[model samples]
Target: MSTTIVIFDPANASHAALLPSFADIHIACIGTDHTIATFTPPLNRDRIIQYWEAQAADAVPGRRIIFMALAGDSDGQQQLAGYVVLFRPLTETGPFRGSVEKLLVSPDFRRRGLARKLMDALESEAKARGQTLLTLDTETGSPAELVYPKLGYTQLGIIPNYGVSPVDKRLNPGTFFWKQL
Candidate 1:
């Protein structure tokens, strides 16, 4: 199957259907007991859809929040394979920095390099916007912890008891990472 990575257009109603699957994927991978900064599953899909629409409408060029998705070709039936969000700070004066948020791939679509593809696209977009740095955080021992380092991100430090796991509701550590663009 061929897949294409593109910026999600919030105005497109077709993309809203993909949000539920994205929520399900995150819940399955991170467990129902944990919540990331960008998503807390058992998602309020309607509210999230509204939020994305608002963000997309209000987005400023080069300093906007974007949601990128990896989806099957539109030639036939289109399927949302994975997604990630890149948030560029809207500060008036400061070093340009972008943050990676909510990187997820469907369980049925794992092991196919979708996450890397999404991240690479995000990095390219950030650099093109003149961003000089990127930052992100992941569960300390999660798959993403390994993936980030492999993608050239430097570990900043681990935050103890940073968040509660969605599956078990137990506290979990989070590791922060940064990359110079």
Candidate 2:
């Protein structure tokens, strides 16, 4: 259980090495985790790659705070076990707020508090950025929808038939939640 949480540093060579694993986590979750019904399976890998690469310049202000939990594998290589991101809008004037992106944990790492750990760091990072409110959504009745309330987020409402499952094209509802940092 050797794990260390670190903010993604795009310029860091070690961090760059895990780029594929970072993308792998998402694809794996979408394909296997029934609870993550937001995206259809066979997701465009380019989407994750482009988005993460675009966040390279935001490393300083951390406008897009990308946190990755790296754990030692059997061969002692650090693998991306889980990750989550907080995106802060660049608007010059307005209420400070951030959007929580997908909180993904490798299935092998589930039930180990990695999601909670990733989220705790996200909330703390949000506060440090002077953000008082955070918002996100998950599939209604999904595990994430259940976890948010326990993590201090209040569910605003559910959007019926909010997404189409890529796996089976089944419609899934979405739950919106927020927390005051």
- Residue 135, model 1, lDDT: 92
TM-score to native of every candidate shown: 0.81, 0.88
- lDDT per residue, candidate 2, 1-181, as tens digits? 6887888987789887776777778788887776463446568887866655666557557678889988887788778999988888867684488899879999989898889999998888888878878999998877787898999999999998888876678887889999987
Local error of candidate 2 at residue 172 (angstroms): 1.8
Q: Cα lDDT of all candidates, in order? A: 0.72, 0.81
Off by over 4 Å in 1: 31-64, 73-75
Best by lDDT: 2
- Give the per-residue lDDT of model 1 (tens digit) for 1-181: 7778887665567765565565556555555325454445455666565655555554545345555555565576667777777777757684578788778777778888888898888888888877779899988888778999899999999999997666655778999999998
lDDT of 1: 0.72
- The runs of at least 3 residues in candidate 2 whose Cα sits more than 4 Å from the true structure, single-residue gaps closed, are 35-39, 44-47, 55-61, 73-76, 93-95
